[model samples]
Target: MNLKRINIPSRLKGLCYTLVIIISFNMIAPIAFAETTFEVSAKAAIAIDADTGKIFYEKNANTPLPIASMTKLLTLYLILEAEKNGQISWDEQIEISDHLLKISEDLNLSNVKLVKGSSYSVRDLFNASAIISANAAVTALAERVAGTEKDFIDLMRAKVISWGIEDAYLISTSGINNEDAQGRIYPGSKENEENLMSAKDMALVAQHLLQDFPEFLETTKLPSTVFAAGTDEETVLESSNFMLPGFYYYKEGVDGLKTGTTDLAGASFAGTINKNGLRLITIVMNANDSNGDGGLRFVETTRLMDFVYENWTYETLYPKGSTLPGFNKIDVPNGVDLSVPIITNDPLQLWHRQDMNKEHLTLTMVNSYEALDKNNQLKAPVERGQQVGELQVGYPEDTLGYVDGSKQKTSVPMVTNGATKKANFFVLSSRSIKNFFSTIF
Candidate 1:
């Protein structure tokens, strides 16, 4: 067909081309989606809710492996316990023993040089061990506390067993690789034994330490501090935990815990963070320097903390003294009132994913009466604030699948809000007669 030539305006042609490009981009561009999964370079790792022994995430957390200087955390625990029990004082002076002096002289191990005749306070030794992971300082403290490192190891093993940590085996007060000493282990030490622990067990140890001696954080959280200040032999000890201030990979919430490194353990960290009253503990073992810049433990720990804080949060689901939604009243036989009001004795705080649906959460009431009788029934003469049952809150198993026991459910005591008395037999009979006449009518 023959067609007449038509001229189009330049601006109109540009507008038409712009519209076509916008439409094509909209059609072909990838849709953005929220990140729900994460990966780390560590061989074994775990994240736990500090308040509750809840495991939020885990990867080979039960695999036994070398934990390096993280073993010092246990040593720190015993020292604090000793001090608490009046076994040792923080200001008590300890002379530099020959063993400690020898260990300090060895440049191959991390140490704070100790003058053979110089005496230091228990506080000094604790700061050196906690902040800088000084093996010599920690060993000296262990010797002071239990009379020998071997005895200290026995105490450590006993304490771990008491805490129900079965898989852990303690061979040293400090987590030094026994093999690194050219096959010459310390005197009284097993030839081939090394401190081996799983991430879960390590987290448990951390939990116990924090619960028993929260003051230890004062030493671990310091980015830099003086060990023997104002003396001619002054030394400055810096924290190896990079999550602390002034170091690379320093996160805002990380406060204390421990770090370990050895040929076998690689870079391992047991770190704790407090953000807006929500505390978390994370353990990363056998992590390597992915970029060869060092601080692989810190890098992985920071990543895990970032993921957790981004996805999980603590929420108070049920407040104390508030009546349960469906269990507001309980039957009271022969009482002044036919029923009495009941409520939770304490608030229920749960650590859950940020995107979790609060409405889907379930509450399981475990009656205290079940312990007394096979029939789940409470007797009259109930007193205010008397615990009658327990409230367990969590998502259904079908919804969240299998979750860690800590994160699975939060339990709180359910109690009565007011007293109820049993009515006399005559009053009960009169009420029954009136109820029978009303029913007949």
Candidate 2:
């Protein structure tokens, strides 16, 4: 039998080679592709370090989806901020406006009924909103904080923008659909439009709330509280978060975050936990509960959390005194020494996954060299262990990325390990004269 020889096009051959290499790489190191390895059932999901805002895993986290009552998280944030700024006191009494009373009386919505002519303390309204996801309580707080719910919506927009989030669409203080706002919708948003935010945005809001006003957790952890105890309008407010201490889906370290659900936003959760000092925040949106039990979001959150706890650990990625290959030193022109060695000032401790390929990690120098010369060289008289700049630790496959979207990676201080002494006046003069001539030429 005669075998016929065939000629392959160069482009096709190169493509074939690339495919083979990719296949070989995948087979050889499946652990490196951590992003694609795990899966969570949700429209958008994310897991992050609550303290550092370092993202560990995410699925469709950047896409803005209906966040439902999670809108209240922002409302809660503004309320706490107002209290901190002395704009409102926790015990300040707010009268039930007819507009808010109308929403509160709606038995269909999650709310604590407010008597038409009654007043409730800010603490009561905050408790109702945080514990039970009460729409009217949140609306009342919004009105009190900004003099109107619409202005509060504007504040929410401004707050998210200040945090580097641009995709958040706000319409209701309670995260209710605009159509469900009962003629009390935000000015510009169209009717029927629900509040939409990316999972990352929700995480960012939660991070700010937890980091800035940690005391808010005091109310959020409540399993049950009375809205207006010993009063006619009194109602029991039970936390919607099933993962709290007393709930069936309870996880040990879980505490104080928020949960949201609506027709538009199926069931979403922004849950946080601090286990052994390593705090984590996980956001899951649009989770499905086939049996209509509303526990699916919790289940998905648990899965995501378990994945993180099992796979990731708090450890040093790069130790102190270590130097990166390319960014290990800086040229010190006009110095006794031509160059100065640089090393990490502190250990780069981060929540990193186990068995991850270290080859995928990279350290890039942050360009904050104020002391650099015209040629990007450090000026003389460098002190030992002087901070020249920062080195950003990077992982390109992190699809969900940091909560602060503008930052590409977590940064660590990069400092000089050895001092670069200033050169003598004669040498400096010679160098300056040579540079002047070179510039002219």
Give the number of the best model, judged by lDDT.
2
Tens digits of lDDT, candidate 1, 251-352: 897888898887788889999998766688999998987565448888888888878778776666656678766678776656778778888777666656
TM-score of each: 0.79, 0.84
Model 2, span 1-441: residue lDDT tens: 111111211111111110001212344554446544689998899998887777878889889999988888889999999998999998898998887888887777888888877899999999999988989988898888898888898999999999988988887889888777778767767877899999888999999989898888888878898877787877777889888878899988887688888888988888988776677899999998789777989999999988887887766666778986677787788789888898987776544566555566656565443656556667888989787776666554544566787555456677888887799999889888999999999
User: Candidate 2: where are CA atoms >4 Å away?
Assistant: 1-35, 232-234, 323-330, 366-368, 396-400, 425-441
RMSD vs true structure, all candidates? 17.0, 11.2
Off by over 4 Å in 1: 1-36, 181-192, 290-293, 320-325, 333-341, 370-376, 381-386, 397-409, 416-441
Model 1 per-residue lDDT at 28: 55
> What's the lDDT for all of these models?
0.75, 0.79
Q: Which pairs in model 1 have colliding backbones?
A: 334-423
| Cα distance off (Å), candidate 1, residue 33 | 19
